[model samples]
Target: MSDATSPVPAAAPVARKVTSIGLGLLAVGGALSAWAFFDEDLRTRFGFGYMVGFTFAWAIVLGSLFFVALQHATASVWSVVLRRVAEMLASPMLILAVLYIPLLLVALLHPDSTIFPWRNPTSEMAEHAVHVKGSYLNETGFLVRTALFFSIWIFFTWFFVRGSLNQDGGRRADITERLRKFSGPFIILFAFTATFASFDWLMSLEPNWFSTIYGVYVFGGITLSALAAITLALSALKRSGLIAPELIRKDHLYSLGGLLFAFTCFWGYIAFSQYMLIWYANMPEETIYYTKRLSNGWAGVTVALAFVRFVIPFLFLLSRQVKTDERKLGMISIFILFGQLFDLYWLVMPNSFGEAGPGFGIPELGPVLFFCGVLLVAYGRFVRRHPVVAMGDPHFEASRGFRLH
Candidate 1:
């Protein structure tokens, strides 16, 4: 995909440099984790916290692939440039697969894991719930479903991105058509796989407590947070001279801002629905999930999640000017990113301690930064190796010229 007049050509050397730095961070992070593993208390808590933070960052990239797929399936015109941003964000899935090894070891090979309460054969929590759920929640099933989720996700993302890149050279309309056709079924498969993965990886933490709509709740945050992160990345690129500064027109930003706004509300609706039903039914099993989050210092985190993740984003993005301004949008994006981290922490950490809250410190901080490094490097490397713009899409020129009325 090399040409003299290409607007965003590949930068393989830079991608290699970024990938190397990412590897270095993983080394340091792993060493620190290994050192902490010698202490039993630190091992369980640190491992669990790291998984929470790593999954938090990893979800955004996976969510970006969903955006890209939906755009293709819908034949969205204005997102042609923006779609590239989503594509690059998805590169971290490759690394995330590598990261899952330790989690697998913890979940399947180890004697017990604090992160996955159901994995321990001897814990009272496991004894109470695992028997009932054992058929579905077995380690083999967990690993299999995880492998399937990533398989479906990674294959579709790779195919979709590779097709888009090929279009950069061939400019074949049929290529776009084939992609659009494939994207329809691919998205349905993605939804199914994501839902089951959520059930296995997250909801299983509590084991006994369950929600029918939990996957949808996770999906809402995934889409919204992914959009927010994309907005921030796009703004950074505009500022750094990576692409034409004027290329990120108000229309593009507006589309992103609109998704962010819509999903913020959607998240609130889903969360409220889940909480409402659980509260109304007052069943012991269903109530435990919310009860854990609402007690023992976690209450503060729950209220903060409502405001920071939903309320604040809702209020700010309500204004058309804020949605249209790159700086303002970027700020909101950063806030939403932090909200996602806090939100995941709220979801995963409390379960590890069992009716108590773990204080946040180096044990939590180190692994999170390490995983974030993996995500950052993967994204930076991806963008460097591909054109910033989907130059061959038929909608490319129209997207460039698009304006908000």
Candidate 2:
């Protein structure tokens, strides 16, 4: 696999299968979302429909990009066998760009009372001192900022993925070096964009409420989710019998598991720190965010995060055996992915409906399915164009002989 002259098998058929499934899911999910839009009750209950769509779409993009960064940061070989898998994750950014249509519609049509309360100039909510303090929370500013965000994301997705595809055409070592060079700057840009993106999309739900660490909190979740996604993708490829079992060793699993553990801790720390600061300060403005979640049906979600997101995974992944076993790691990945979704739901839903309970009804399921479909199709297309591994990569031999201990 390391030989530059080695023949690389074409990935067209597999790519097509992946694309078909992705498109099929998108159609089904899109239909559900369409129905939710027309169904007044469902739409009202899932009041954060637009926000959910935006967040889910962006989450996948950020998650995939974060995986790329981690791969570079650790210089791990196990992931070399799966680097393409991680790179393909970014393919959804294009589809997500289109998904923003509905969000743009919501902002344009309901400038005042929609998700961002600050949009409504005459509303009493807008008169509050906190809302007035932020000049960027307005309707026009929101649209402009969103457009800029998507543009930057789409550009990086194209550049990075394009370079990988070019490598399949027998590019030199310099091509890989170019990617590494771009990686540093890309990571920095990703950190800033991801933070502000969370603030703009999720935090603005309650214009008066703000947290300095909220961006880092969201990044932690995104990173964890991306790792889960990578594990799942690798498992799927193995199941398909396309990936060589020997290529992915227990050491790789352990490394990925360790990353999951580290981020799990980081997410908990951020969540607790934010909560504690607000609790100690007892400021009405800051405390109001927690107040809404603690009351009504949102309280259940809070408890779910405490146990599902942190405690359970924390204990389960603590073992070296569990971390190194692919099947066990894959199962834990699935759990973490679902937990992250629930975490996002807990964050956005409370503000959408003050006392309304959180349910995985059409409003929630529709966007999730739709975006998921898009992700599948895009990733499939990417995989089809490139070799599953970097055959010409200088480190390919090192990756092949990678060991755990």
For TM-score, the strongest prediction is: 1
lDDT of 2 at 107: 47
Evaluated at residue 28, the lDDT of candidate 1 is 72
Query: For model 2, how does the per-residue alpha-carbon lDDT over 295-372 read when each residue is reduced to its tens digit?
Result: 887887898888889999999999999998888989999999888878888888876667766656778787877777
Cα lDDT over the full model 1: 0.79
lDDT string for model 1 (1-405, tens) is 323333454344444555677778767766677666667768877777677766787678888888988998899888887788888887678678778887777555687565676766677776666788888988888888888888888888788888888888766999899889998998899789878888888888788888889899888878877898789878876676666877778888888899889988998899899999999999997898888888888888889889988888899999999988899999999898888887788778886665666468666777876786677677655665667667888888888987868
TM-score of each: 0.92, 0.91
Q: Top lDDT: which candidate number?
A: 1
Candidate 1: Cα lDDT at 348: 83
Model 1 clash pairs are none
Off by over 4 Å in 1: 1-31, 120-122, 126-129
Tell me the lDDT of candidate 2: 0.76
